[model samples]
Target chain A: MDKLLRDKKAIVIFVAPAFLLFTFVLFIPICQSVYYSFCNYDALTKPEFIGLGNYKQLFTIDRTMKIAFKNSMFFLIFSVVTQLIAGLILAALLTNIKKGRDFFKNVYYLPCVLSSAALGLLWMFIFTPKLGINQVLAQFGIKGPLWLMDTKGYIILPMWVIASVSLWQYVGQSMMLYMAQISGISSSLYEASYIDGCTKAKAFRYITLPLIRPMVATAMSLNAIGSLKFFDLIFNMTEGGPNHMTDVLATHLYQQGFKYFKYGYASAIGTVLLVLCLIVTFIINKFVKVDNYEM
Target chain B: MTDYIKADGWIDTFNGGEGAFSQQTYDGKIYAVPLNIAAACVFYNTEMFETAGITTMPTDWQGLLDACEKLQAAGYTPLTISAGTAWCLSMLAGYLCDSEGVDLAALDAGTASWLDSNVVNATNKMVEISKYFQETAAGDTNDVATANFYNEEAAMLIQGSWAIAQINGANPDFENKCGVFAFPGTDGRVIAKSDSLAMSATTKNPDAVIAFMKYFTDDTAQKYTAEVGGKIPVTTVEYDASKAPAQLAYVMDVFGSAKSTFGFYNESMASTEAGSTFDDAMVAIYLGTPVEEGLQTVEDFYKNNVWNK
Candidate 1:
């Protein structure tokens, strides 16, 4: 078995299918997007080589690009911070409670399993000014500010509303990851810590958190990538409306590529998004400080 | 191998005559046959109008505003428009532009700017009229807006002739209550769209395709267009109005009386991108962007992206 593992032919045979699939499906398309970012292709016309034009326009003159970039950054920061803190708290609470743990876990994780498109539509109704939440607010003599339509301010009210809804839907996944990591830590360590007069909080800080650093890195990276590419919920809710205020990078890319047929400009946006995801993931991995703990 | 159908000889037989070929013609030749045409108009609830004490329909810009004021005074929502769907707001802007006589051709040719006085006035007028829209107009979908009108929550909806079918389908009882009129201030001009038929230029069986195309504009089909589909047939074939939906009579009257007709501003733009940008600009105005600023964005888009192309 050892000799077979080291065989070059065996390695090649094992890696060939995955490598080929990756090349055709992911690598090739990414390369094409990078190439297209520098060209003027409208799907119907032959691509014209235009060096730095799309990028120049995106950075310098495009107001929508600025809005999209700011919104994406907001979503990324909002998602990562909230998911980490909320996930840790939920994981700690659920782990200590032996009774009805599964039931509580299922309740928290339910939204993560539901379709975002369906959830977005449901939330749209809830947030509509003349409907759901606003109607309840009206009953209290409180005129609710348009939750989904308010376009005032830089970040805008709708962006915050959407970000909160996204957090509600996704925090469960983060909680589940942290819970799995917590449950994997030996109960003997907690027993020893408690015997030494350590509080539950101290045990969580020294034993549980330090041991789960690797998982935290993984979860943060997952979350960073997910938030940067966030599209479906926002698209279903706003389609980047109230005059493009809620547009993140993905929806803006969609508008440029599919709605407007500016494939080259859209590719430029896509390239920016890809680069952003990579940089964020790298930062998360580097900062997370995962030390191998021998349990 | 590449020869488009020339329907110029038979074009005059259509309801709008040669004018119906406005969309189907290219380079001094006709390429397709229009089967049915539809126009956008104002559909109001007759009961709501009577309750609002509007003795007569508005005929011009000021009168329309006055009518809206009356409707609001009577505790009725004056208008229900879909700003959430950009095209619906853009359609309203299109009518305003038409009323102001903003030359679409001139704008396309770069001879006129979107910020021109007429265009600016048109946009301002749109903002002025938007005050009477339903409370959630900015977030309401087209379906919701239509529901507002048919449900009697709103007194007016600016939609196309195609809405006749949707309105009737949603509430058959709304058949008699709904009445149609041309958009005020356009002097009876309407924004029109049509479904046309064209044979493949390279088809081996041209005769077969032609036979199929003719069937669309034939008496039976044309009659069905009005009676069942609640659309305006392009051909001059007569149909029984009594057999058609009651709202059809009002729409037919407006269509018949239209002094002129033009295509949707969005559809008639240089590119779909330009059209969508126009939609965004209109929606921006609806969302309280200054009229000059919103129109400037559209002008900037035309100058940078469209005119150069």
Candidate 2:
């Protein structure tokens, strides 16, 4: 293996298939999207060069695009914060427990096994106006706001509902990741900290946190990207209604491309989303500073 | 279609009849066969109406609201609308537009504004009728709204003749208890559309495809469509009216006596983008967006996307 790796041609031959697959699957589509974003095409007519016309309209004129951008940012912030915090807490609890740790972990992981479509339908039922949360609230003399249909709560509540549902479904994966990272920490560190007049909280803050910085970076990047591309749940639920209130960039792109057949405009939205995700990941890595501490 | 003409596989079977096939003909060459002709109107449960002591279907918009109020007061959910599906809500708004005499063609031609009095009045009328919809109407899917009517929780559904098969599939006995009426209008016009099948121009086996198309227009298929499917037949074949479902007969009567006819708003529009904008505008009206603002959204979309093109 070392001899083969020493030869540059042999190395290229070994990696060529995967590299070609990646280029065809990811690079080609992204290049096509970038090209389409600059043209005015509707899939039926020949594409005409418009020179940033789609982007200008999307940023300056489209009200739904503004709403979608705002909503996507909200989901990104909340999903990253909630999932990371909840995962850490659950991982800590699982590690400190005396028994039934695997059972609890498996139970938390069950939702991740289900498809997002099934989870979306389940959450839709739970948020249904008459029969789900509202029904429970009625018995306590409290009228719940129309969970999915409430327009007044548009800016905050609906996005949070979606964020929390995503959190519920994927937090287990985060927890397991944290658990794996935490388990790798030596028992001697906690013992030394205890002898140095430190409590469990202090040990967690100074020892456990620094050691797991790399894992935190990984989790944040994954969750941020996932939240940015969120679609199916929102699509099956309100479909960006009560009149585009819950609209996100992904759903808006879908409507523009599939429903309206505005391929150029939709590609513009997709390009913006791709750039936004890359910027977000870069910012998160800078904030986390994954290389600051040793493993 | 030109390719099929070149290949000698295309046929002009209808000979310029004024129904579905003729609607699709271009320069005296037919390219498709229509499966059924359906209309958008009101479908009500007979048992619910009898219990509510309603004797006659309304003939105008105001009278329809009066009937809805009575049904609501009679301990029944008055209507079930699928606001979750934008087009379902737009169907009622489209009929209301007809009653108010808003010419969509003129609007498309840029001679009319969507914020005109008639168009605004039509939007307001949809808001008026929305009060009688089920409490969960805005959240209900098409399937759920249909279920609400089938479960006897709602007295009426503002849907098309296509719903008859769905109702029967839900409860086979509903075929006998269901009744149909024309959508109320200012002068009594109704909206109509055809569900048709189009053939590909380049085909490997034209004979088999032609046979399938022929089966759809034959006597047995036409009668079966009228009798079992509760749809209007486009063919000249005859079927027993008494043997046909009552709701189908009522729809036929409404279609025959309609003062005039217009195509469905979504279908007759110049582009799907314009149609979807109109649908979203109607949904906004239901969600408390001002009538003028909602209509203006569509007008702006039409100007920018359709007219500019």
Candidate 3:
């Protein structure tokens, strides 16, 4: 073991596969993107590099890119915060309840078990103005505007609705992570709190919440990562419609890369997405330091 | 999906009219039949009209509104669409542009601008249509119109006719009930969206393919489209409008008078972002957005994604 650890050649062999994978899967594509971002390269012809041209256009000239970027940021903030808060509340509720707890756990976890494709179709019926929940609302004499089909400004409210669906479908994993962390905290701490005549609220505020902080960070980080790549349910639902009002980066990448065959431009968008995700996750880690904590 | 040849001897005797280009080429060539055709028309519910005591089918824009009011007053939703498919909006946009006599091809090819006075005015026309019908649209569930039409929840739907197969695939006893008409926009010209089957570069059986095409376009296949499928066959064929099912006769007439056919213009023809940006602007306008700001967003996106870059 000592000999192997001391051998630089052995260490190099161990790190080589990961390094090569990072180069192939991440670095090389990003470098290609950085190069393409300067050019008006539409996949078919030879690329013409004009230096920072694409980036400059995206900022100064592109209206849709601004909307795309804003929509992505909206999802990132809303999905992460809502899912974390909702998950924590449900997880905390489950941790306290003594009866029918398993049933509640299964019920709340059901959306996670569903494939997004199936959920999207089912939700369509629910949101359909004629045949879905909107129709049901109509029976009670309530006329409803088109929900997903309405593309007028929401003043940020539609973002809330879309984010809620995202959070609903995903909170299970976060809730489970938080619950697992809460369970691992020493029971003796709860007993000691009671012996000291601390209220249940005080015990929960100080003991349960602080003990689960690391897990909260982990859940939130995962949620942020998820919100950034969101495509399927959004695709199946609005398809970035009411004229691409609900469009996101991943789906935009999909359309440009495959449907339109603008490979270079799509790659540039993908590279920007990767950098944004990395920066966000790094900032999160800096604040919480989840990896450094232990129960 | 099933790959049986339908018996070559039987195909030879049964009728070779429908395959057209495919019929002439395939046996001497590498491969075979059934190319795609795009179909869009105004499909309406006969049952709804009957229930509302309306005898004549709505043939123009005002006529469509009159029917919508009649149907809605009679306790039915006037129109239905599925925004989930999304391309429907662009189809609507295409039809709207065609109505205005603005060549969508020119628009797609960079010869025309989406924000041009004509195109913007056309878009305004569509927002007017959206408001007129108060169309009940949801996700990719336009086929819901088929049911709503049958069940009398909605009176009409504008959709691609390829969906005729999917709609009729259901075993509902709609009494051979639904019919189609050419798009009636701004009352100036009538048109339909046509789907085509482009020849792929890779073909091992070129002669067989040409033969199959010829066979498919023959009268036999054309009749199959009218009588069995209710789709408007491309090749000209003589048939009795009265002998056809009630729902299908209107389609033949509509197909007969089509001034010019268009395809899904925005997604198929525009640059990467133009169609998408235009699609969003349309939805915004439909939801009561100001045309000035909406067109500005489209113009900025158009400049960056197309002209400026």
Candidate 4:
């Protein structure tokens, strides 16, 4: 086995297939998107290089990019913080529950397992004014504002609504991860804290809290990235409508690429999204690097 | 060869597979057939009509409101709309305006505006419809609207002919209870949409598909579309008034004598926001935003943010 691992031919054979596949897929698309970023290729026309013009429009000329970026930032910061707390609380609750704990865990994780489209459809029905909660609210003499259709962007209603949806769909997943991380902490730490005359709350704060910090950071980072790239749910629920209140980077890119057929502009938006995600993930990974140092 | 297929939304007449053409031998004349279709007219329960005390399907503006009022009095919603998934509501809005002889095609191309008198009238009509739609039924979607009609709950549902197949395919039985009519406005003109067949350049069976198109466009096939398919024919094949929906027979005549047949509503126009994005304004309209604002939204979006920006 050692000799085979050291063999040059064996190495070549093993790496060749993966290398070819990567070159065909990963490298080509990145290269193509980069190349397309500077050109005007509308799928119908031959490409024409315009030299940073697409980026120029994305940064300065396009109003949508700014709105998308702003909305993304709001959700990224708000959802990560809010859902982390909500997930941890739920995880703690599940940990303490003496009855049907496994069943409750499965039920909590079910929404996260559903496709974004299915979640969005459910969200639509839940928030739709006439047939949904609003109708129920009417029985109590209340008329809720049209959640998805509201265009009065003064309050950022659409962003908050979409963020809440993302939270509902992803909090379960974060809860499960936090639960696992909490379980991994030795029970003896809690016992020691309690035996030393600390209360349950203090034991939880001193033991379970610090132990799951890495997991909380990881889950938050993952969910933040998820919101930044959120496309399908927003697309189906509102199609970025009511005067583009809920338009995001992904839907904007799709609109430019497929609907408007502005391929170069779309590529630039994609590159920006990729770079943003990478930068964000890198920053978050630094805080969680304590685990890597031990390994 | 003309490139289109049923999968692309033409009638499933012949060669209804991936290919575009079908064979035909009509009167010893051999030619390539074409796939084409149009929007349909619909009518609801006349009992609801009578409860509204509407004696006839309204032919003009006055009769239209009288019908609506009567339908309301009879405890049924008058209009059937499904604007969320489909742009039939927009089509109806456009149709009402076009019946007055406004050139909506030009308007769609940005040569006109919602500020135009005809457009304003259409907007007013929509506003009226929204306001008059029983508050209970105003915001409900199309399927519910159809269910309400079929279950004898509502008086009418204004939908395209393709919906006939869907209604017939359902568990609820209408069975000669529902009827259809031309949407009345503009003093007798009809607003309609047509679907067509065009062959792709990439197909290997172009000749065979063309042969299929020929068969599909023949008189016999045209009749199949008219009678069985619940769609009117592109060619001048006459329908037997005695056999089919009386409104359809008259529709065939009206289709023949139509001053103009608008292509599928703005949403069906390729590369336009009228379908995917701009057309989504229906939700906004239901939420109490004005129609002119909706039109202005698309127009401003086209001007400020789209290509050439």
TM-score of model 4's chain A: 0.91
lDDT of 3 by residue, B1-309 (tens): 112234343234322333433422334442334333335777777887888777887667677778878887888777765544555655777777766777656754567766678877777877766653435654434565455555655677777766665666563465366867677763534434433333445778755654665566577876776666666655556655554445555554665566545446554444646776666666566566787677777766655555654
Candidate 3 structure quality by residue, lDDT tens digits, A226-287: 89988878777766665556777887777777777776667677778888889988888789
Ranking by TM-score: 1, 2, 4, 3
Worst 10 residues of 2 chain B by lDDT: B8-17
- Say which docking band candidate 1 falls in: medium
Q: Name the best candidate (by lDDT).
A: 1
Model 2 per-residue lDDT tens digits across residues B1-309? 434433432243332244445556668776767777787878898899988888998887778888898898899998999887888998888888888888988988888888899999888889989999998887777888888887788999988887877888788877778888888754768777777777776788877886787788777988898888888888767888776777788898988887766777876677886787788788878977788888888888777766777
In model 2, which residue pairs have backbone atoms overlapping below 3 Å? none
Give the per-residue lDDT of model 4 (tens digit) for B17-50: 3222323222443233444455556566656665
Candidate 3, position B148, lDDT:
58
TM-score of predicted chain B versus true chain B for each candidate: 0.94, 0.90, 0.71, 0.75
Error of 3 at A37 (Å): 3.5
What lDDT score is found at residue A199 in candidate 3? 90
DockQ for each of the predicted structures, in order? Answer: 0.62, 0.61, 0.50, 0.31
What does DockQ come to for candidate 2? 0.61
Q: What's the true lDDT of residue B63 in model 2? A: 81
Candidate 3 residue-pair clash tally: 49
